[model samples]
Target: MQLDDLRQNWETFGAENPMWAIYTGRGRIEWDEGEFFATGDTEISEVMAVLERHGAPSGAARALDFGCGLGRLSQALAAHYETVDGVDISEPMIEGAKALARQPTGVDESRLRYHLNTKADLSIFEDESFDLVFSLITLQHMRPEFSRSYIAEFCRLVRPGGVVFFQLPTHRTTALKRLRGAAGRTMRKVRRSLLGGEPVMEMYGTPRKDVEALLTTGGLRVLDVLPDELAGPSWQSFRYLAIRPDSGD
Candidate 1:
């Protein structure tokens, strides 16, 4: 799908069922306010622990959460960093995130902020603006050209000595699954062309080699690539852990 199609689909999802769209396992009316944010805490805690093991990102002053649907991960990052910024493509999602942050139970309003960015690149934020640049289950939805550019942006946005962690599928694990994925994409294209109604969700992958080369081109040092379950059962996905080499001043 193109960027406009992605934005339209996610905007609808954000308006109708923000929480359910981010985490599909939850029912539309079933997301408990407290429990939903708590999942963010758990996820960020695990991510921080992993980073700690590698001695990453010399400081924890600021963080940026790309594609931060309703600030789920952004709010959680606030506990570790002094401030957190959440950027999303949908206006409703950003508005919902701001509203949630106003509550007493939400992350401190002063420490967390949300931004609406519909552009393909993160030009709104200056280079090396964050100690940790993160994205989760966000890149797989867009085509690789867009996703690759964002990955390069992740590398640029992170401060020297900081880390960039994101997930993307490399390919389907089985031939049947590959056929199914191709067929699904073809059907979605046909549906969009013929019906032109609600936006359909799509999945795309960048080969591992291309991803590594992109990171290298962005001047990030590949640290580790861990297999992750975020891409679902049919696809083989991985979370890349990389760091920008510190500049000797």
Candidate 2:
């Protein structure tokens, strides 16, 4: 699909169900700001623990949350890094993220900022700009070309000895299930055209080897490929952790 197609679907999602869109594919959440923000705390904490377990002990000075929805992770990430910038393709999502990024009275929200990104590649950033690059449950929504290009950008944006953590689907359905999904995609497209409701959000899978090669080309050393059941076992999700080679700062 074209970039605009992807953008349209997510923008529609953000406009209609900002909360549910961020935490996608799940059934309706009760939809309160308190619980919503709390989930962000939980996710960043879990990711921090995972990073520590993998041998990165120190925290980042600057971090980037790629495809960060509504600034949820960015708020939690600010505690780990001096500054955390969340970037997304949708304007509505970024607006929601900015609204939530505000701290209470006398508290500074400078550590967390959200930006709206329209480019497929992260050309907006300089080389080696971030100390940590992170994305979760986001890349799988884009086509492999977009994901692969962004993988390179993620690595390029991280400074030496920095980390790149991201997740993508590594498998696809086969046999009858594949047939059913193809039909479902067509139906969703038709419905979207006819009814003008929420656009059909499609998921794409990328091969593990292809990702590793992209990281290598992007000047990062492959660390580990952790299996994630976020999209369930049938979908085969995985998290990749890579580091730029250099002495720790």
Candidate 3:
């Protein structure tokens, strides 16, 4: 699927089930702030632990959270970073995030912000603007072309010597699963076109070498890559921690 197609699906998904859209398995349950934000805390905590283990350079003043649905992790980030911007391509998600930010749960709402960006690239922000930028479990849902473009953008927007943490599907599914995936995508397209059903969420995987090459092309130094099996064995995932070269470079 294309970028526009992915956006449409996420917009519909966010409207219908914002929490479940962010974290599946909630299964049509109503939005519960306690449960949803707790899940976000779990993710951020785990990522922070990795960053600490690798000496990823904490003390970040400004941080960017890409594909930040409903401000779940953004709120969690407020404790570490001076300023946190939660950005998403879906307007419904951003609106829900704004409402969540106003709930007065002592999240330092002033430091946590939500932005809606529908563009293919992250041109809204300037070069070397953020101390850290992260996108988790988001780019995999996008098309390969868009995913590459954003990875390049992440490299550009991050400050020199800053850190970046992102997750990518390192390999495609097996032949049998590939066949099933293709058929599912085709049927979803047909159903959406003919029956007017909501857009179906789509996922794509990129090779590990291809992702590493993109990181290099963007002037990022690969610090480490760890296996992450979020999507099961069919689609292997990896978490990459990279650093932008010093300004002297």
- Model 1 pairs in collision: none
Instruction: Tell me each candidate's TM-score.
Output: 0.95, 0.91, 0.93
Using TM-score as the measure, what is the rank order of every candidate, best first? 1, 3, 2
Winner of 1 and 2 under lDDT: 1
Please report, in order, the local distance difference test score of every candidate based on alpha carbons. Answer: 0.88, 0.81, 0.84
Residues 146-197 of candidate 3 have per-residue lDDT tens digits of 9999999999998887888999886656888889988988998888889875
Pairs in clash, predicted candidate 3: none
Tens digits of per-residue lDDT for model 2, 143-243: 78899889988988998878899889877656575576568878877887888756767777888899999999988888888888766445777889999
Q: Write the per-residue lDDT of candidate 1 for residues 80-167, one digit (tens) a residue.
A: 8889889999999999999998878887887898999999999999999988899998999899999999999999899888889898
TM-score, candidate number 3: 0.93
Q: Rank the candidates by lDDT, best first.
A: 1, 3, 2
lDDT: worst 10-residue window of model 3: 23-32
For candidate 2, the clash count comes to 0
- The reply for model 2, stretches above 4 Å from the true place, is 57-60, 103-107, 193-197, 247-249
Better of 1 and 3 by TM-score: 1
lDDT of 1 at 97: 95
